[model samples]
Target: MSRIAELTSLLMPHLMLAPIGLPMLTAALLLTMKEEQQRLKLGLNILSTLLGLLVAVALLLWSHESGAPATMGVYLPGNWPAPFGIVLVLDRLSAMMLLLTGFVALCSIVFAGARWHRAGVHYHTLFQLQLMGLGGAFLTGDLFNLFVFFEILLAASYGLLLHGAGRTRVQAGLHYIAINLAASSLFLIGASMLYGITGTLNMADLAQAIPQVSAADRGLLHSAAAILATAFLIKAAVWPLNFWLVPAYSAATAPVGALFALMTKVGIYTLLRLWTLMFSSEAGPSSLFGSLWLIGGGMVTMAFGAIGMMASQRLTHLAGHAAVLSSGTLLAAAGFGQNALTAGLLYYLPSSTLAVSALFLLADLIDRWRNDGASLAPYELDDVAPFLTPELMPTTGLNLDEDEEVLVGRVIPAAAAFLGLAYMACTLVIAGLPPLSGFIGKFAMLTALVNPLGLGSSAGTQPGLPGWTLIALMIATGLLALLALTRSGIRHFWAAHDRPTPQLRVMEGLPIAILLGACVALTLQANGVMRFTEATANGLHAPGTYVRAVMTAAPIPGPTTTPTPERAESSATTKAAP
Candidate 1:
């Protein structure tokens, strides 16, 4: 009976994730029912999202109550032990990610209904499936399972992207398809390489096993890591590979664009999850891989995104560049791979996603603009109506140009304001500005990076701060990006003279509020959030926690299905605490 209870407790978290999967499955079933089942689909969408959110909340509560990571299980095709079969694990990270996925989906769905027509086939169904994929990716502890989720999402996104009939959309979707398919292929190849090397697919098991592998084989593992990173980087839109972003992001409808924000973050999340555990190289009494490759690469990616953003002319393209900017900034921070890097990454997940997502809705208004600014000149509201109205403007009006007619009908201008705020928030946070979380993360990473740790740790006058040239350049690049973004922000807001504008809707404004609110929340709770992120980063740096969690019931011969451990001691000397 006690065993049964333990098993039940273990299974509960997986049970929580089931709602996400069931909805997707049901969506597939509903597809064959009829074209008139839109209502059913709608109800399912709402029901599934609500249920998922509820489960996420439960898992979070349960995790807190138990004072440990949640565990769950569901055997496939006759009960079989994990190594030969598959299982899911729901750690704190998984639970947090699930909640975020549900939240974003719910908001996007609500906004979608208000705007887009129900003319399409099973629009809600595809959405549910997309949620299913996202939730699956977060919940699954198994690498193969992660791949399954990836395919699920990639397929769903392809369908969603191609929905409706526009020649440009079709063209864009095809391009999106081609690029993503290539990424998927590389992802598959990398997974295959990893499996061949390690012989197991469980992330936890692999984490334990990787550090044990011989140094000679490190080459293969690094190669695999590089390939995997490449796939995700493309998805994340790292420069030199981001040509598809401007066109794809610009072509999508507002709702589509909003949903797309979470898409690339998936890659960033994966990088943090997998690479940190499996590939880091540290030295000395506490060797860990805070990741030194960051300095040059990150700076370059940041510069590229900044250039793209500043150069963009149209609203759509500008939004696209903003997305690019997001990847570059976050990826650069992530590459630093320290306590601060984790903080920035945590802050980034919501900040940039919110900014870019809302910016799209704002841009949509501007894209269709044709109102003569001469019309609404008399009213202080009219000049700012396009952005201030219920549709485009968010609840926060603390930063608008009052009395001046400059903000009228131009969706781009309003979007520009939102972008500016979002950028300033992100830049401040990322560039490590004082009184902001970004500054804290940057400072921490610089501590780790230049040390004989080589990136941040320097001799004399600093225990944490390193005097590496790369670190200096990163600081410099961040300052430069900050200046450029802020200057552009001033132009977008202050440069505008009064002009006539149109009204906005409640639906449109919600995204902006949600996004900006996220920024505010991150700022307000930086200390607490950083504490949690410290916990997360500790788990990331110390593979044992991850390994132990995944390998809980492994056999004596040890993790029969896990990939062989590689570079085991490289991270052994590192000190990590959440």
Candidate 2:
């Protein structure tokens, strides 16, 4: 019974979802407010984000202090239990992912504050709902519950994708919605199959019960696993299944696009969690299902995404394609199935989320910057002048060299030039070229794949190494992304998109400085960061700590009946798990 209390405490952090959730709901409702009162929605939107940040921080503290896995409310509408009810589990990884989601969501909310409400119906509201779904996916332990969370996020995403209601965005969103809904249905079918075979909906219960499944059911189990994996792969943007991701991501807004950074990672998280846990057992000598397929497919997926990035043109489209590459990298790491790669994934997840979010937002600013300038490229630039007032082009312009003034449209400020440099620095780190978190993530992947003597060697014929090579070929793909970015950089400092550019403003430096600071800090703290990631990865693999926390207490004594007299034991045949 004490376990119940512990579970509730773990869920305390999830309450952070409410702050974002409520205002978003309010935004949807506030469409009734007179246009003159629209500021009310705006104020509430800002407040909701601030509230979410505080709650997320508080939850992080609670999780830290608890320092153990916990489960919360089996709470049901009619007090149902077991297969009839839903359950939420907060393990170490789940808690960490939730915290990261909250942090990134908070930042995106701040970015959208002034920009979103005017764009479409209940824009901020949908963003909040999306967060709710993301948080739920990380927190829920039940298969059906995860599906519900996945759908919730998709539901919100549909509106956000079409937020501006632009003809192109709306059409793209239709394809996105239709495709994802099919995936969701597949997820549900897979969940039903697992439940039918295992006779339990709880993940922990399934883990213990699946071991006892009959040989007759192995096909069912394997098929279910495959179907479930397909659903997540579709979500993860894996291989040929990922064709839809680029178009949808390209069509979305900067902040909306940034929000997607967490979406696919959530899918990858599900794959890693489900395969490494519940399904694969380290103690057993037998091979686990989908081990080779997942690893090999991951390699192909990485290559596909890299090719997409190389081929894409629009800056937004390029960033979207890069996400595909990142997805493949994540899959490759997970497929390697080594502790180091798993740990690297944990480390990579948050850093990449932040970097991607920052880049997407900056892409917007760059888009506007391009429109203003004219000359060399066919792309739009918001300005053409070499110098402008600080208000318009803060921390922007060409020729970031020390002596030359920073210019955007025409505004010049020393601080602004520093900001442009800062952005350049951040972009470099994200490309995995330097001492930043991305570099560390890549180093871990390389070690896991190529190390002849380490974890890779111990796992005979490991598929993860080949998978890593898939992304390695795309290492130059970052440069492809960098190529488009270089044009803007050159325009700001060396030349305008066409004519000489204008001075930049210090105000615009804010995001550039912040993103660069993250990269620099990540680079400096690589050691400590990698260590924690290792810890996270270890926890994910065995999840012994979590199992113990949930199932640890002495099992409740069941029956008072005496044991039956010993009978001849039958040699019951054992069946292989699917």
Candidate 3:
């Protein structure tokens, strides 16, 4: 046992880098193989993704077990000191994100193996590269490398978006590429400006420098931060800057869409990390910089997303809008800067992401099922049944048993039942209804917003106007989403009489089930998950701890030897003679 413990400790640092390196190496190896060997490639891709998931789980457990001020594992790739070397900081936040990325990637790759992998030339390679980029982005401790990983992921996403190569995909892919290219340029400019102002790109170093920045350059610093935030906001699909998200995400393949769900959260994660670190109460004049902008913009984004959802007719478009809604909620919660609210948002993030991804996958199956039958013509509002009157109802046939006794209920096909249940779960979760993880998360956030302090505290005060406004918006959006999803569900499952049951492959169905099953697990373990998120939030709010951990981390010592006695004596004698 002692030997195993020693071995594990020695190898843990290297394991910190495996999430990024393993996928990259796998992608490179995949390039050498022919496309004809797809089964081999598929197996390799799944194995790599599973390994990444395991590594992520291990890291999460390590971070959790290490306890607070939150143990941050800092790995210097070049064996150089902080602010000078490539550093990867694994904290609770980064570990959680890494785990989410691995799980989503694994599910997506498995789903793609059903057919989408064969849709393009280097699908598996690009998918692996996408995972590599996401892992790097989460683990990197510097702004420049964040940009590098951003480009890496976006470049890979360009190909994944156009996997099927249809006209719609080509159009959406072109727009996605153009917008991201522009955002990348902005990222570079903002990073360069910050580097010039602070003389360092490491996040910890930046945190240490933000408070000491000269008054003269403070405005420039704020400007640089805003410019950088604009880039992330665009990626996060926060309204106005998010015109392209619906079309782009709606057009991508199902598996690609599921993975793309995490891409938006990357931007959210960056904002959360930077805001809590650089603009905390300790940052003098820059304390909570841009809080109003985040709150106000997030509210507007939520409104836009709600309206978009209510108006959307296609399942894919509805799912895209739902993603936007989820992003908006997170952004607003982040703006509040309350520890409890932050914890709630952390819990909400994964629940909403999983629900949205499941919806995306389910949308493809439902659409295919619809396509398998006769197409229905569009109907006007008046044409939709205002209410099902007895006179208007059809009395065509009754489902009866062989004995002519009336059956209590109709027997639904297994595939159709699965689709309906999955869709229902997605709807309930996204709508933040009761008895699911989503409701628990939203309830926590609402409680925090209303109290802004712990319950039963004597000094508790009412939520201010902004808080009330956010609360109102959240409720309204939930109602709107419920209506929208219910309508879509009826059309897809209940109203359509001619559509055939979808032939769902195990590869396809299993991923959706796994994702939904995760939501169920979260619901069952809500208390434990909330505890973890609260600890993560507490660590994030205390920026000084993070700064100390990163800046004080020592590099691995290079090989060295003790001087021999004879050699030391001869050197001493020579020095004395001189």
Candidate 4:
């Protein structure tokens, strides 16, 4: 074999480490650079993000081609055994999330490059650190490590949230920071309690041990799980706990707001991961413990979010509420615990996230134009000359003040046209209207819920109330979003009085175009994307394949048999007491 081929083969096994490690290195490099080194900062940020995206895409394709979750990549750092040393599992779900994170981070970074990055110190450093945390969380197979990454990302987010110093930004950042600190405390307490009971922090190991939990300890275990679920639910922004989401996200600078979109989904991802792995049917009596609560809470969240969307007068707040609605829909589907529903969720997840992020960026641009003082004011009826079509007026008579009159009959500004079209695109996608990826994803979900059996199944099995309820709420929420977005659009686009056309730079506009273009591409390749999500859902429903894949990744150095219930109980007691 050629030298290059040999080197590639040698490094292939370690490729899984690149996503997390590369960003850490880049963040350190960025931290040491001087603040005024904008050129170096921009180049390094783009290079690191591009490399991360490439690696993420490679991992995604590798997982897809492998065709089975069990065959998905599993790398045991330091060649350590399962459930002992750190393990990184690259299954379909994680790979997909990694890809999404990389793509979103890339876009946000590029958009920030347009100017947001310079608003504060260490912007690039914090950005890279944020990616490091996000990447580590998605890749880590250990719960404790998940918490570590959670804090890492949260810390980075604190700095990024206040990146551009302003009164509104500082207040929002404080609220965000305080709420997350409490959540972190809950995370630690819950994780410690679980560790005491199960004597394991590795997710695969916990999955194996959950079914063997003694009845005497079930109450304590349930309490720990509840506490942990509460923390996750708060982050996921389920109704009552979602008060902080809008203010923080809406107040953030445009690029940072785009990054915050993924932060919300991280909570959803954690809930799905731990709940399915630890509380599935394989875990015996603990199976589907909070399913009903999840469904009901999710429904209520959707209702509340819909109300918020309707009440919102600003585009940013409207987008924020849309995120809350998206989380509710996904959480409810997850609560249903059906492979078909999950498949639809996987499809919808990316489509909704990307659409909402683009909306945040678009909102910033439109706001700039509406508030800019230098641009020409909107055309007024009083500023126009009443025309009788005599067509013989002197050219000098037509000459008027540039700012006060429209010499060339009403002309639509290019920036305004761009914003208008982008707004329409965002509305269609966020509202799940037809001919976009959003509609297809929701349609897939509706069809799956309505007909659990394949399309050719025999008659007599109708969808339950839960399924129909979900459908109704989804439609209602979409309509609410439509109404809210329409009002905001009209206020900004048509009914405007003295608003100026915002000057949009190519750099800023390009990122928005790329994100929307991606949505279009996802719609064009909907079939393939659906197939992949279907496979992902199937793998999630049957998690044994995942557990086995991780467990068998390396030698355990002992007997492979699971411990007996009595022995496991004795071990649990001994560990809990210690």
Index of the highest-TM-score prediction:
3
Compute the lDDT of residue 58 as modeled in candidate 2.
61
Clashes of each: 42, 42, 0, 0
For residue 277, model 4's alpha carbon misses the true position, in angstroms, by 0.7
Off by over 4 Å in 2: 1-36, 61-85, 282-287, 373-419, 452-516, 551-578
On residues 52-166, what C-alpha lDDT tens digit does candidate 3 reach at each position?
Answer: 9999999999888756657778888988888999999989999999999999889988877755666567888999999999999999999989999998999999988887665
Superposition error at 263 for model 2 (Å): 1.2
Q: Please provide TM-scores, in order, for all candidate models, with all chains considered together.
A: 0.74, 0.78, 0.90, 0.87
Worst 10 residues of 2 by lDDT: 374-383
Q: lDDT tens digits, residues 174-233, model 4?
A: 999999999999999999999999999999899999999999999899999989998999
lDDT of 2: 0.63
Q: After superposition, how far is residue 347 of candidate 2 from its true place, in Å?
A: 1.0
The per-model lDDT (C-alpha) reads: 0.60, 0.63, 0.85, 0.82
Superposed by TM-score, candidate 2 places the C-alpha of residue 90 at a distance from the truth, in angstroms, of: 2.1
Rank by lDDT, descending?
A: 3, 4, 2, 1
Candidate with more favorable, higher TM-score: 1 or 3: 3
Candidate 1 weakest ten by summed lDDT: 370-379
